[model samples]
Target: MTAGDPGGLDFWSFVELANRRLAEEYGFKHQLATELLLTLNRASNIVTYDLEASVHRPHGLSWSGFRLLFVTWLAGPLEAKKAAELTGMSRAAVSNLAKTLVADGSLNRESGVRDGRSVLLSLTDAGHRDMIEVFREHNEREDEWAGVLSPEEQRILVMLLDKLVTSRDQFDVRGRN
Candidate 1:
């Protein structure tokens, strides 16, 4: 199919074609791993984009911003380093996002009690209210996404994903926290 053709092939079709081509031309093997990783990444991106567009952007938050706010709202007043670890974001990113959130009156940043150079972040009163409202909508969207599968299937998927995540230590792969 031509690359510019709009209705030529769907995603799975493209993946299948690529797999066949790679196997034929490059002697590539590992199709199962390739397919699994591609499907996982695609699903994550689709859900993240949908959630950002439908739930977060209207409230002036990106996925990252919402994530920062979500973690802090649920588990503040936490050090920025802790927030970064929980959010799977870098410490520098947490610092920068905190500045924006603080400027918007949605977060409070204070000096750490034990260390002068450390920053502790917490949601403000308005931040708490906003987070509750936003989280209600967020959870509703999450429910809609999760509704595609049966409860047992969802449980199994979660278990499998957790297993994959926890098994990272078995390999030398470096990934987000």
Candidate 2:
């Protein structure tokens, strides 16, 4: 399907087609391509897209921008590199977004004491206020998404995801030898 096609297949439909094609044409393993990783990727995209549309966009923030504010608000002052690590963003990306946030008065950046080359980031008073307000609505969206699964299922899913993340070094992203 073309990128501009309104009738383009939904994500799972594309995944299903890929799974079949891989199995038939390349003799790939069905379980590996169609199961855990694809499902997690799809869910992550949908959830992020919905959150951006429903909560972040109305507040004049992109999801990543909001996340930067949220992390700083929750963690107090942190070096830009630290913020990038905590937010799962690249250092350059965090630095760039920080520039906009600083200009907008949502965050403060100051030279680091321990390192002359580093900058520490913290929420400004206005930034803290805005993030707190936005977070209340963000939590509501989270609740709506979590409502799809029962509490037990939610707990189990969290545990499973944690397991995978914590064991990330075990997985080889490049082709296995």
Candidate 3:
């Protein structure tokens, strides 16, 4: 099976084979699929390690919780739908997590200005301090832990990740099975 000569292939195998064929056909190719999988996996591990090394100790901010919170920090005072879109999480998941964070006093939610139907979300005072502490400790650990990677390497890695995210839209991977 080749490009445009597609045969039966499930999602997993299809992506794998496509990556391989892409390298062979186009040459000097990046393993887009494997790069994506490993990038997510390595990121998860780094976050986990950083969280465990947190100095202030656990404050009910699991990795998933932190994920929701981190997005809020990045694009806060946002409507629920927009937050979900930025985090790449489902609206229901965002809503549910928002409820939990609100109850924990780590998030503040109110009615959206433009959309009466939408709810705006942001970090509460508690959430703000918590996020700052978490990130400070996390960044410290990152600097010490990832010391092997030079500044240029880190910059290159970030550029590659950004490129991969943008490339997904151009791939047209729908209904490839």
Residue 125 in candidate 3 has what lDDT? 86
- The lDDT leader among the candidates is 1
List per-prediction Cα lDDT, in the order shown: 0.92, 0.88, 0.77
lDDT, candidate 1, 1-177, per-residue tens: 434564778999989877887788788999878988999999999999999999999999989999999999888699999999999999989989999999999999999989999988999999999999999999999999999999999999999999988988988997654
Off by over 4 Å in 1: 1-7
State in Å the error of residue 67, model 1.
Answer: 0.4
Would you estimate the TM-scores of all the predictions?
A: 0.94, 0.86, 0.67
Candidate ordering by TM-score (highest first):
1, 2, 3
What is candidate 3's lDDT per residue for 17-40, written digit by digit as tens? 767767887774668757578658
Candidate that beats the other on lDDT, 1 or 2, i.e. the better one: 1
Pairs that collide, model 3:
none
RMSD of each: 2.1, 4.5, 8.4
Give the number of the best model, judged by TM-score.
1
